[model samples]
Target: MHDRPAPRPQAPPARPPAVRRHNLGLLLGALRAAPSSRATLAAATGLTRGTVAGLLDPLVAAGVLAEGEPDRSRVGRPGTPLVFAGSGPVVLAVSVEVDGVDALVTGLDGQVVHRSRRRRDHRGLDPDAVFGRAARTAANLAARTGRTVAGAGIAVPGPVRGSDGAAVLLRAPNLPRLDGCRPAEHAGALGEVPLLVGNEASLGALAHLGQADDFVYVSADVGIGGGIVVDGRVLPGARGVAGEIGHVVIERAGRLCGCGGTGCVEVYAGLPALLGDAGAADVAALRTAARAGDPAATGALARAGAALGTALTSVLHVVDVGTVVLGGSYAELGTWLVPAVHAELVRRGVATGPDVAVLVSPHGRAATVTGTARAVADRVLGEPDLLLAG
Candidate 1:
C-alpha cells in the first residue's frame, strides 16, 4: 500500500517560550545593527509595538540594554534611542591553532575590548594542558577588564560538532592531542557559561562575513585549512568537515602531513613548510629576506601559492565560488604569494569567473578569534533569559 508517504513525520510546533526567544533574537539583531526606540524596532522587525516593548522592557531592567537621550537631529522630533548596556557584558573567544593560542574579548556593540596571544609550538602536546593555558588566559583577561563573560567560543584546528556550550573535537591532525577532546567541558571547568566549539577556518571566515556574498576563506598558517561561504553563509557540509582542503593529496609520496596523509596540501603550503623552505626562523625573518630579494624566501612563497592554487581548483570545480580570500597569515603575506596563486589558477583554466577575485582579509591573523567572539556575543545578547538571566 502507498500509505500517504509515511505521514511526513508530523512536525512538532514551537512552544510559546521558544517563539518568544526567536522574536527576541530578531529584535536584538535589529538593535545591534543600530540602536533605535520601540517604534523603530517594531517597524524594522515587523513585530507589534507591544511585543517589542514587552520583550525589551525586561532586558532593559536586567541591564542588558539601556535607554539613551533623544536623538539630536535638526529635521524632526527626536526619538529616545535604546542601546546595549555599556559596562559589564562581554564574550570571550579563543582559537587553538597548531602554533599557539589566541583569546579575545568583544562587547555587545561588537567592539574587541581586549585581546592576548601565546605563541609556541603546541603540536603533539596534551589537550588538557593547552586548554588549561587557554582557560588561564581567559581568566586573566576577565580580571583585567572586569567585564562579565556572558559566553565563550573556542575555535579548534579541525572538525567539530555540537552547540549551546558543548562540542567534541572529532579529529585534529594538526594538533593530535586534541583529537576527541571536549572543548566545552574544559570551558565549563572555568565556570558555568554558554560555549561554542567550531572549526578554525569556519570561524575565521565568519570574521569576514560581510566582505563578500560568496568566497572561500583560506586560513594559511602553521596548518592550512579552507572555509567555504556560499550565498552569504558558511556552507558547513554533512559531518561539519566541508572545507578541509588541507588534507587534499597533491604529491604522492611527498612530505608526510599531520593528518597521516602523505603529500597533502598542508605539507606543501603550511607556514612550517614555507619557513623551513626559506630557512627563516620566523615569519618576520622570512618577510625581511624576501624584501631583500632572497631567492629561497621568494621561491618558497611561489611554491606554497602554487600548492594552494591546486588545492583550490578542486573546491571551485564543485562549489562554483569565484573569490578566494587569504586569511590568517596568508593575508599578511599576500603580496608575495597572490601572483603565483593567480598564475596557477589561470594555468588550470579555473580563473573563469567574471569578477575572478583573490582578496586578503583585513583582519589578518586575528580573524578566527575575532569571528568566534562575534558569534558567541550574538548568542549571549540574543538570548537574554538563557545567558544573561541571574
Candidate 2:
C-alpha cells in the first residue's frame, strides 16, 4: 500500500482573524507598558512562546516593534527584548482651545517628536481657518519627522458628536466660531488621514490612565470641563458627553451658562468667571496674585474649587472613583486649588470614603494635547493593519 502512504500529517488548527487581532493587541499592550523578552511576554500574555513569536513577526515587519539587545544576565540561553520601535508609526494631535491651537507629532510611546503652537484670537475666527492653521502645523511636524502618520486626533474646546466628529457646540461662548461648525467637513492639511474629534477634557483624561486605574480629570482652561475614568476606562457616557462636568448644575441660581443653562459649574468655575476683574491677564498672573495674598484672586479660586468639589461630589457618588486630577490651567493653581477642593469635599463628606486624593497632573496644561496624540497612537497600535495598509 505504498508503505501506508507515510501517514499524512494533519494541518494545524486555524485561529480566526478576530482571535489573532486580539492576541496582537495583547502583545502590543504588554510591550507598551514595558519592554520584555519573548519568553516574558508569552508568560504575561498567556500565549505560548511559539505563538508569541508568530504574532511578533508581522509587528516587527511593520516596524511597530523592535528586538533589543539580548539579556546576558539570565542563565543559559539569552532572551532578546521586544520594544516599541523608535521609528514606529506616529499620530498627529491638534488641540484647539479658546485662545489658539497646538499641533504635535507623537510616537507610539507617547513621546512628542515635533510640536508647534499657534496663538491666535479664536473668538470669531472662521472654523475653516482654525482647521487650516492646525493642518499646516501638522504638515510641518510630519515634514520634520518624516515618519508614517497613522492618524490625526483633534481636541476641541466645545462639544463634539461622537458619531461622526460633528461639532455639537450649542454655543461655545468662549469659542463662538466653533458654534454650528463641523470641523470634520474640512480635513484641512491632514488630508484623508483618519480623524477623531473629541472634547478637550475627555481626551485630556486619557493621559492619566497610566497614573491611576480610576480618577476624575478636571481641565480648567478658558472654560471648565472634565473626564471621568472608571476602572481603567474612560466613561464617555451614552452620548459621549459623560465627562461634561462643567455643565453640571452646581448652583440653582447661578449665572447663565453658554449652554443657556443656569447655575452650571462652568458659569462659576470657568477662567473668565474666576478672573472677574481680578486684574490678572493670565493664569500665571492670577496664581502669583493668589500666592501674594490677593484676596480677590484667592477668593475666586476658592469659589471655583468649591464649584469643582460640588460637581465632583456628584461624580464620585455615581462613579465612586477615589482620585481627582487637576489638569489644564487648574494644574497651575493646584497649590491652593487642591486644598480648597479637598476642604469642600470634606465639608460635603465625599472625601471620607475611599480616602479621596486630589493631585495635580504631571502633564499640566499639555495633558489634552498629549492625550489626543496618545489616543490616536493607541488605535494604531491596536490595529497595526492600518499601518500595513498605508
Candidate 3:
C-alpha cells in the first residue's frame, strides 16, 4: 500500500455484467438471424439500436460478428447489415462408441468442417486409454484445421450421469465396461479446455430442436436412446440418468438383455441385436428384408415396434411431450416403426388430447455432433443460463 501510487484516480464504474450479458444476448440473437440490419436486430431482440451498435463493436473485434455491406438503397437512413464471421473459434465434437470413436471439427455455425473416425478394440480397453485416444484425435483434427478450438464436447454411447458427468455404462447395450469413468478425467489431455460430456441422444435432441423446444427425440442408432425437452430445455432427470429407454423391459422372461434383464426394449429394437438375429450386416439390409416381406425381418420389426411403442407410452405418460422426433440410421424405417408406435400409443390412450406428433429427426448422423457444437457456442456467446433460470 505504501509503494503503490493512487489508483490512477479510479476509472469510471464499468457496466454491470447483466447489462453486458443482455447486450451480448442481443448480439448473438442477431448474429444467428444474420444479414440483418440494426433496425431489424433491435426489433428482433427488443434492444435499442445504440445498444446493439455498442455490443457489435466488441463482438466484431473478437471475430464473432462482422459487418456486412452497407445498404444504401433504403430511403430513410443507410444501415449496415450484420453477419456472423462464421470462422470464429471452433468446437470439436467426438462420439465414443464401442467399436470406434467418431469426431467432427465444426465451426461456430455448427457446420462440420472436418471429420475423422478411428477403429479400436472396444472390448477390454481401459477407460483412460479410450479417452486419451479421443482427446488426441480431437487435438490432431484441431491442429489440421488451423483454428483455435474453444472447447470440446464428447458424446458417449451410454447414460452419462448428469450429477457427476461420469459415463454410466451400466444399462447400455454393446458399450464397453466403464462403470465409474468420468469424461472430465480426459479433459486434461484435451488442453484443459472446457469439456462437455452428454448422452448422444440428448445432444441429438438438442440438434433437432433447431431452435425450438418441447419435443421428444428418439435416437435409433446402435442402440435406442431418447431425449426429452420441455418448453425448449432438455430435461436432465435426477442424476443425469433420464432417458434410459433402452432398458425399459418390454417382456418378462423373453430374450435376455445384455444388461441382465429379460426382453428389454433395446434387446429387440437396437440395430446390433436385431442384426445378430437376422444375420444381416446392417439395419438397412434388415429394413430391406422386412420391406420385401421376409417373415423373420417383418416379425423382428413388428416385435421391435411393439416394444418401442410400449416404451414410448411410458415416456408420454410421464412427460407430455408434444412432438416425438425419430432420427439416426434406423430413422429410414420410420415409415413402418412410427405407425406402430403411434398405434400402440393410440391403443393405450396415453394422450388426452390430439396434439402429440411423431416426426422424423431433421438431422441424420451429424445431429449429436452439431448439437454439442451448438451448446459450446451458446456457452461462449454468454447465453442465458437455461439450467439456472430458463
Candidate 4:
C-alpha cells in the first residue's frame, strides 16, 4: 500500500532548541552574576542538579568555565567554585572617537587584558586607516594573550545600523570621513571573529548596566549623545538611533547644527558650544573658568545646562526613568550641570515623588572604551556556545 510510507520514521521527540538555549542562558547568567558551585547554580537557576551538571560538562570541556578547589569554609559538604575560564576566550573592543581609536582586549569577567590607543586629528580621518590600526592592535593583543577572539565591538561616535557582522556608520558630522564607513568590511585582521558596531553613548550606557536598571546616560563630548536604559535594557529603538539627544531642538530658531538642524541641543550643550571663544582651549580650561566664576564659561554652561535640562525633562516624562547619569565631558561638568538639570527636572518633570538622581560617571572619559569592551564580554558570556564554536 503506497510502499507503506517507509514506516514514517517516528518523528524525533519534541525537544525545543529554545528551551535548551534558555536553560543554558540561565545557568550562564547565574555564573556571570557570581561564580557559583553546581549546586548553587542549580538552586539559582531552578534547574535540577543533574541538568546543571549536564550543562556544565560541555561548558567546562569547551573551556568556557572552570571548577575550582572545594571551598572548605562551607557549612556542609564543600562545593567547588565555578568561574569563567581566564584563558578561554576574549573579545576585541574598538572605540573610534573624533580624535582617537582605542583598542582593548577584555576577558569574560570584564577585565581588560590589553589595550592600545592611537591619537590623531579626526578632521579628515580615514576609515580604512582607523580600521587597519584597530585590527592590527587587536591581532597583536590576541597574539600576546593567546586567547581566542570570539567577537569584536566598535564604538563609533555616530549612529550605526545593522548587526555586528555588518554595521554601517550612518553619520558622524564631527568626523565626516567616517560617514558610510562599514567597519566589518575592513576587519581582515580579526579573522572570522564576530563584530559589533554601536554608538559610543549607547555602549557607554551599556557599560554602566551594573549600576542601575533604568536610567538615562548622557554623554556630552564634541556633540551630545545619549543612551536610554529602560526595564533593565538599553533601548536601541527601531533604527538603533534612539538616543540622539544632541539633535533635540531646544531652540525654535537657535544656532545651526552640523546635522542641518536649528536650535539643536548640540549647538548649545556640546563641548565646543560651551567652550566657544571663552579663552578655554580645552575641557580642563573650561572647567577652570566655570570654577573661577568666569561669566562667559559659567553663563555658557548654565545656558547649556538649562537647555539640557529642558530636553531631559521631556525625555524623563516620556521614559519615566528616574536616574540620569552625566557621562563623558558632562561628567567633568557635573558640578555646574547637575544642579541646572535638577532644577529644570524639579520644575518640569512629572510629579513623581522626588526620586530623580543625576550623578557624574566615575568611569571618566574611558567610559566609552570600557563600555565597548564590556559589551563584547557581555555578548560572549550570554552565548558561551560562541566560544565552543570558535
| Reference-based lDDT, each prediction | 0.79, 0.79, 0.71, 0.79
Give the C-alpha miss distance for residue 94 in model 4, angstroms: 0.8
Candidate 4 lDDT tens digits, 1-390: 011112222553454667777788788777767888887777777876766776677889988789877778777677787888888787788887777777788777777788877786666757777676667766787779988788888788788887576788898878777788887777678777777788989888877777788999999887889899886567777676788888888788988888887988888778887788455789899899888899988887788788888888778878888788999988988999988888877877452435988878888767887878777776776676666676
Tens digits of per-residue lDDT, candidate 3, 1-390, equal 011112332444577979878777756755674577766776778865666666566667776556788778766556677776666677788877777777888766666789887787666767777778877887788788877677778887777775223444343345455655776675456865667778888876878766457877788876778888875567777665577677777777878876677877888778777677666678778888978888877766666677787888887888877777888865777877777777777778875435667787767776777776666666655643321121
Q: Write the per-residue lDDT of candidate 2 for residues 1-390, one digit (tens) a residue.
A: 011112223564788988988998888777878888877877788877777777787778878778888778877667778887889878889887777778888878787798877787777778787777777777778878878788888888866667245545444657676676667675578887888877888888989988887999988877778888876556756564678888888888878887778998887787888777466788889988999999888888888898888888888888878899998888888998898899888889888744999989998767888888878877777786676677
Compared with the true structure, model 4 gives a TM-score of: 0.91
Tell how far residue 388 is off in model 2, in angstroms: 2.8
lDDT of 3 at 239: 66
RMSD of model 2 against the true structure: 5.2
Q: How many backbone clashes does candidate 3 have?
A: 2
Model 1 ranges with Cα > 4 A deviation: 1-19, 97-100, 119-125, 163-166, 231-233, 236-240, 250-256, 276-281, 346-349
Looking at model 3, residue 170 earns an lDDT score of 40
Q: Deviation in angstroms for 142 in model 2?
A: 1.2
Ranking by TM-score: 4, 2, 3, 1
Best by TM-score: 4
Error of 3 at 224 (Å): 1.7
Better of 3 and 4 by lDDT: 4
RMSD of model 1 against the true structure: 8.2
